[model samples]
Target chain A: MAPALREFCYWMDRYRRVWRGTVVISVANPLLFLAAMGAGLGKLVDANHSGHLTGTPYLDFLAPGLLAAAAMQTGVIEATFPVFQSARSGGNYPAAAATPMRPVDILGGHLLFVAFRVLLSGLLFLAVVVAFGVVGPARALLAAGPVLLTGMAFAAPLMGWAVGVDRQSRLNGLYRFVVMPLYMFSGTFFPISQLPHWLRSVATCTPLYQGVALTRGAGLGGSHPGATAVHVGYLLALTAAGVWAARRSYTRRLNR
Target chain B: MGDESAGAGVLIEAVGLRKVHTPRGGGEATEAVAGIDFRVHRGEAFGFLGPNGAGKSTTMRMVAAVSPVSGGTLRVLGMDPKTHGPAIRARLGSVPQDDTLDTELTVRENLLVYGRYFGLPRAEIRERATQLLDFARLVDKADEQVEALSGGMRRRLTIARSLVNRPDILLLDEPTTGLDPQARHLLWERLFRLKQEGVTLLLTTHYMDEAEQLCDRLVVMDHGRIVAQGTPRGLIAGHCTREVLELRFDDQEAAAGKIRHLGDRQEKLPDRLLVYADDGEDALKAVHRTGVEPLTALVRRSGLEDVFLTLTGRTLVD
Candidate 1:
């Protein structure tokens, strides 16, 4: 635990210098996205089919879904490039390995750092969601649970996968093929009920869809205890699996 | 191998150490560090002298406890690496062949963060960073990112980072392989100072001059095996003569037949022939007496290069 925190401190020290650039992505960009896509486009959808969105305001429906998706994007972004860079030959992991720190410590530290970023982004994003009247204070507080877990579910696994990636260009493909598709299809913009029946079932199983469902459920008012547990459980399972994979991969690559 | 240092405590020992690396894609298993044995004393500057791919770095990796030894009895800091890697590593400082400085961090932060890896307190690390910055001569660039530094500065920073833990044994693998002559000299001076400070040093290099300069005792490795092990002067004395006379001829094979008897032994290269004798000048006169007016002739004292040539029939650096 101490060694892992040391690795986390290394990232924190680096982050202190680069925090300004991240604010734009984590806070401003998501707000801008809310304004343009939620309020700007919501007015159109609300007027044409006022009751189509379950008799709730379109901004209310879109905000929490967007928050969950943003967390997913943040998770993937945080995990991909930096993880690949460290796993490369002559990169940071080998340097870290030379110290008393073990491979598990290195992996734990970076994942902890990613979780920090996701939490910071989630908090700031939720603050704006409340400021925009998207969700009330109590509901926004509830929504934070899924928002942060959603980030880890994606973060832990993608970090594991990123370690094995051979090329930098493949990360671009991940954003295009994996992340963007989930963002578009996983009930972020509209209800998954609007999709084809078979595709809706597929979306339901995805971690992002679970995230969107939980956040939207919390924002809209409430959900059954059983449904909430399933959402949280699914995300937890993926995160655990991802962390296990990451530890194995890091030890294999570094310890030789 | 250093009989004089036998009374000193052994900090690292390997008996018939072996490392076999099976390729990831299912090829023949390559024996990287074939059966070898050596011991490093507490404060001696030991080295592994060999050409590239001679298993010098492989052996260093094993000593560092980063790579698992396939077969053999190996101990570092009186502990088995397989069971006590972290404990062993806590007392070891490693400077890899390539500079692994964090390009993302500032010059001083490299030391700070690495110190934290060893669980150094923040205040202690800050004080140490100040001293290490001065040591590496990068005080002016302490806040600058590593990417902004020159190759030499980066190498210096790496060495400084390795020292942040105040380690007992410092392992450097080809520490000056890619540096300029001036950079290499400055690094050697820094390393010499560390030796004066009583830090146990273990390094590997393909440069015979580097070995001769830094190492008190070294082992010559070829194709994953130790070909010879001793002090540089001792190996040269045992395998070669007091001096060497180099003669270049247009036809080395024909000229070799004529002057072969002049020296104690001879080594034929594509461009020149080396004549070993007690006195190189006398050997040169003997070659002249043979009427072989070689293209060029030079006489110099024998060194590790000659020792390796005699032992392995190959140069240290290709």
Candidate 2:
């Protein structure tokens, strides 16, 4: 574990050079989404349909959903391009393999950096929403934990997928076919209950919907006691499984 | 091929080492190494001389402990690569055939970051990076991104980065494959200095001149097998005559029929014929005495290329 952390620090030095660009993107992301989706669209919805959006201002209801979605996107981005680049094009993985570092250490270090970015992005998202005066109280910050979890849950599995892929262009199909559809229908923009009951089941089965539910419950303060364990369990199990697959895949692909 | 290193106790020992790569998407497995053996001792520069498909890089990869061995007993620093890969790798440095530097990082930072992979202290790594940059003659370009540098500079920086750990054994696979003559000479000079500093070097090359210049002992590989092994002079002396008379004739059939008895042995190439003799000048005079005026003629010392041609009956690069 210590050696793995040392490997993590190596990337930190490299990441430090381009961190400003990452910070600008991470900090700017939530402000734009909250301004456009929360302020502009929420006012129109609140004016036409007041009580239909869970008895609060629509901005308050939408803030937490966007937070979870932002976290998921941050985690996925961290894992996809960088993981593929490090292993193949960038030649960093082979360099590390030539050293004392093992394939597991490389995978651990990569995932560790991704988790850090997700946490940072999650915190930035929460602060943006709080500064806009949308979140009700201080406890709204509690939602950041589940949001980061949701991000990592998506990140770990996507890392395994990214390293297994040969061409970077194939990732476009993943975004267009899989990620975009989930982002639109996974209760980030609206409540899943508004959809047909059968469509709600499909939305419920996805990880982002659970993330939205967990974060929204934490933000609004009325999460069902029974579903809390279920959501946490689902995300934790997915994270563990994803990490296992990533470890195996990295060992096979990297230790050639 | 149990050829010992040049007077140094063996640091690397192998017997019938083999490698077979299974192509992705479930294709048939292709054998890259066919049970070849060699050894490298401390403070000696050893090499594998072969062409593109001769499995030089595969053998180098196995020695680096990044690629697993398929068969035979192999030891690096007296440790088995199959189980003690990390432990063995921690003691050795590797420069692969291709440059994989993190192009985003500056040259100095590339060295610094690679040192951290070996778990070196930052202050120590910083100190060593300074020395290595000077050694590679890249001190002036320390702050430049690797992507901005030329290919020769990147190759030097890559070699310098591998030395950050002060490793006992250095494995360089075709360190100068794409460089121009000037750049290749500069790199070779730096590598010779490392060999003088007592770093055990294991390099692979198809350039016979490079093998002869940098290697104390080397093995000639063809089609995944060791065809010959010795010092550059030893291999040439054992397989070829003292000198060769190269004659190019526009009329190939006329030269072949007439020059058969001029030298001890004769080889007919597509464009030229090589006449082997203990005294090349005597063979040239004998050719002239036959009254055959050729298109071109020259007498040269036998080299690793002649030895390779003798053992494999094929050109090294072809």
Candidate 3:
């Protein structure tokens, strides 16, 4: 356990050093998206609804969804290529395998680091959401828990996929064909009601969709408790499945 | 030369160990280790001498606990790798065929991070890293990123990294495979010092001179089987004649045909002819008496390469 903790800390420190560019880019993208879509598109929504959106400002309706989307993106990106690189190209996991730490410890240590990055990046995005005057400070703090959980829900499965994948080409295709499409359709920038019925069904089933709905409900205060519970259930199921798959992949690859 | 009795206990023992790797595309499974048995005593350097694709790395990997045995039984430090891998691996240091150093980290940071993997304390890791940097002669480049270092420097740093845990058994796979003569000699000297300090070393190499210089005993493998195993001198004396005579001619076939009649044993290579005899000088004289004037003649003592060629019916390299 002590060795696992030390390995986790070492990776965290290494990531912190190597990920400065990523952190900057992550912080900048959310701020830019807010300026463009929140400010630009908020004008159109407000003008159409007489300076109100369902009796709230246009920015308020969009801010929480953006926060959730940013967290999911941060988590998936943090947990995907870098994880694959450590396991394969960088041979970092092989180096760790030579130590007293087992494969499970290695995976757990990496997940710990990914979880921390998700939370920290989510907090940074939350600060941006607050700067846009989207929610009160208390609600924003409350929103962080679900947003961070949403990040983990997305990260867990992506990490599983990363381990089983031997090539980056397939992951690149997934990001383009699956992740981007899901992000666009998942009600981050708009309401799911705007999507077609068949597409809406697919969007509602995705973990990101549930994450965005849960975060919006907690941050913007219109989502009901029962609806939020359903979303949480889906995320929990996905997290469990992802963890099991990741454990199996790590054990198979390492032991072989 | 040192106190041999102090390090006489068995350090590694294997009973009919075997490993089979199924190809990714699924054909017949290749038996990489086919029920080989051997024991390595404490404080002695042992080697696996084979050419490429000869199962040397596979055998080393099993002993390192990174590769599982498909059949038979094996033990390192008297611990089964399947059950006690972590404990067994903790006391073992491995230098793999390729350098796996973290390219993004500085040399010092690499050592520190690797030591941390072994649960070493920060102060102790720092001290050990410092000493290793001095041992590898990379103290001047301690702060430089590993990617910027040369190959020899990186190889040395890797050796240093393996010592971070101060392991009991050190496994080096082709430790000087591509190194220059000077670098290879330097590494051999460092390894000799480690042997002197009573660290049990296991090495795999294709370089016969390397085996003769470092290994006290070695196993020659071919086609996933141990063809011969003994001390270098013993194997040479047992399998090959004491001396060899080389006779070169413009036409290797004519020289080989003529030389065959001059000695009890002979081998014909494309470029030259080799006559194996207890006395190379007397064999040369006998070949001269055959009245076949060769372009050049040379005589030298036999070594491991002769043994490998005599047993395998081929040289270690094509």
Minimal lDDT window, size 10, model 2 chain A: A48-57
As for candidate 3, its interface RMSD to one decimal place is 1.8
Best by lDDT: 1
**lDDT (10s digit) by residue, model 3, range B1-318:** 112322457778878888888965679988888889999988899999988888898888888887788888887887778887888888899898888899888999999999988887889999999999999999999999998998888889989999999999999999997888888998999999999999999999999999999999999998888999999999999999999998889877766676666766888777778889999999989888888888999999998988998998788877
lDDT of 2 at A44: 92
Q: Per-residue alpha-carbon lDDT of model 1 for A1-256, expressed as tens digits?
A: 3999988988898899889888776778768988988899988888877554877778888898899998898899989999999888678888889888899999999999999998889888998899898777887888777888999999998988888889889999989998999999999999888989899899999899999988888888767889988999999999999999989888877887
Q: Which prediction has more favorable TM-score, 2 or 3?
A: 2
Q: Which of candidates 1 and 3 reaches a greater DockQ?
A: 1
Angstrom error at residue B178, model 2 = 0.8
Show pairs that collide, candidate 2. none
Candidate 3: residue B56 Cα off by (Å): 1.8
Best by DockQ: 1
Model 3 per-residue lDDT at B266: 86
TM per prediction? 0.93, 0.94, 0.92
Off by over 4 Å in 3: A49-58, B1-8, B23-27, B247-250, B270-272, B281-298
TM-score of chain A of each: 0.96, 0.95, 0.93
